[model samples]
Target: MNENKKPTLEICLTPDAVSFIDLTGKIAVIVDIFRATSCMVAGLASGVTHVVPVASVEDALSYKSEGYVTAGERNGEKVEGFDIGNSPFEHMEQEFKKIVMTTTNGTQAIEAVKNTAEQVVIAAFLNLKAVTSYLKSQNKDVVIVCAGWKSRFNAEDSLFAGALALKLKGDFWWEGDEILFSTHSYSSVKNNLSKILKHSSHYKRLKEHGVENDMDFCLEIDKFKNVPILKGNILENLAK
Candidate 1:
């Protein structure tokens, strides 16, 4: 890190791009605004103890015998045998001590950078303020990794990366074209996020699965202050 320059921040628009960047020693804020990270923040704030994010349905199901309930979705629908889908409202409704979850894109995104970054923090509009504050406190180079739909770019995650970039511009050196683009785009639609994103790809996918409300809850900015930090294999938040 060049001390003379401001702490650097950039956005990795998809999981496929994760390898091209060096994540070591930097704080990676994982954003999956269409749902996964939003569910995590809501779960912690709603009294769930921990979330174990896995990349496969088999891995998430394996935890059921240990008293960990399974929650997940594939291609926008809940996996047939899981206890719950990846919905922020479900996290708010159910009571659980811990959960193992897998999702179409979010967990895959986590798998990409979990080991490489010095720290990994979950971010969603639900915990936007908390995430920004967490980065500011660490004062390290930052990368907002967006979990785009599958292995391709999606607008919601990119919009979120922009929303986060807007919050951290003062403390970090903007380092990529993605950052510049998201920042400007988010500024124009921040007040109308739901309207701008409605009927979009992820939204329509989730809507077909009857989880329209989940998308609404996921877009609520600053709704929770809990910062779900990945510690070892699970993410836990002690925030009150």
Candidate 2:
């Protein structure tokens, strides 16, 4: 809480490690770059009122009767009977007031730190600058939680975490093993994100499912000026 001392930056490379991270008094930024967090950013930017991220398809379905649009994916495909998949493009197409979404990794990451973090914000390449700027303004210690693929380490999420760390370097002091790895990973791919990520596991999975366009969209830096911040289980546009 000392203004003169720099806030610290840490990284949780996967949701599996979220349990061990102490999020108390820190601003947790959840990154699921392959799609989920990207879609949440796109959805809010496209005029959706709020997004409720649940841990499973069943949890998302529970909001169906409440007039919430159900969206999510299991194994890189849209869940049967759900309204949409975890594609940012799909999110931008609809103008629903409320959405209940779940995914293999992103939502689980959010749920992991929802109770412990002082504040939770969703981040992706789409709104990178906005997110970093907001975090810098808050002056709180930050924990960047990467929603890795299926509870395992993934390239895209770590890269985003690294990018955030690099951006916050002047305002925060980096800590943790993942932060070091992320910083190097981000620096290596600073010039060519799409090219490097094409070889990633989730990227190939999404490509096989024929949603390469979504991958392209998610990698664009600062595509939206909005930052989605979680409040009481719902993600709302911080820009508003």
Candidate 3:
């Protein structure tokens, strides 16, 4: 992020990989296409004030005392006792002014780089163009942090990183084989993104959890224009 010329773009495929990536002063776009980030984009675009992303259910539940509507999920299912699940559609409803949410993967990734990155933005296929545009405007070193399943690599998030990287092709200098690998991954399935992604592990896992319907909406591109940028652990729409 301290570079003088055009910024560099890098991809962190999983939370575990964050150890090697220097996010200092960089803009980290957190991608969790299956649901979490999709929900963040959807909620912010729909006029919700802020979405607070917490690392664990305990962290999320603690916010309840302050009147932040609580929402969360674990292993693809809504956590018991929470007011809502991690679904973009549920977020689209906009039942509350603010929310504190946690997810099995996405929130964990957000927590990973919150302290290191200069700015953390939530992203998904739902707001691909918005996120890409925002990053271009920032003109800072970019790290596309894919919230892989449980701190491990997952196809959907990497696919999202690929699509975003492809969009930012001329804006920033690309770095590492991870970016190359993701770009190829996205190009291979771009024509049939939804159909092909239906075979992904997280997709199949959500199906087993009875929330497979969320996948189609999550994959819908450019459905929103707002980019949710994290401010002190709370995400507020940056584009608005």
Cα lDDT tens digits, model 3, 1-240, are 335477999999998898998888888889998889999888888968999999888998999999988998988889999999988878877567889999999889999999999999888888889888888888889998999988889999999899999999987988899999999999999999989988888889889877777888898999888888888978998845
In every candidate, how many clashes are there? 0, 0, 0
lDDT of 2 by residue, 1-240 (tens): 545598888898888787886788999899999899999999999989899999987888999999999999988999999998888877887567799999988998899899999999999999999998899999899889998988899999999999989999889877777888899988998898899999988899889999988999999999899989998988999855
- Report the CA-based lDDT of candidate 1 relative to the real structure: 0.88
lDDT at position 39, candidate 3: 90
- Decide which is better by lDDT, 1 or 3: 3
Those runs of model 1 whose alpha carbons end farther than 4 Å from true positions after fitting are 238-240
After superposing candidate 2 on the true structure, give the runs of residues whose Cα lies further than 4 Å from its correct spot.
1-4
Write one digit per residue (lDDT tens) for candidate 1, span 89-204: 77776568798999999999899999999988999998888888888888799888999988899889999999888888788888879988898888888898899898588898
TM-score of each: 0.97, 0.96, 0.96
Pick out the ten consecutive residues of candidate 3 with the lowest summed lDDT: 1-10
Question: Model 3: clashing residue pairs?
Answer: none
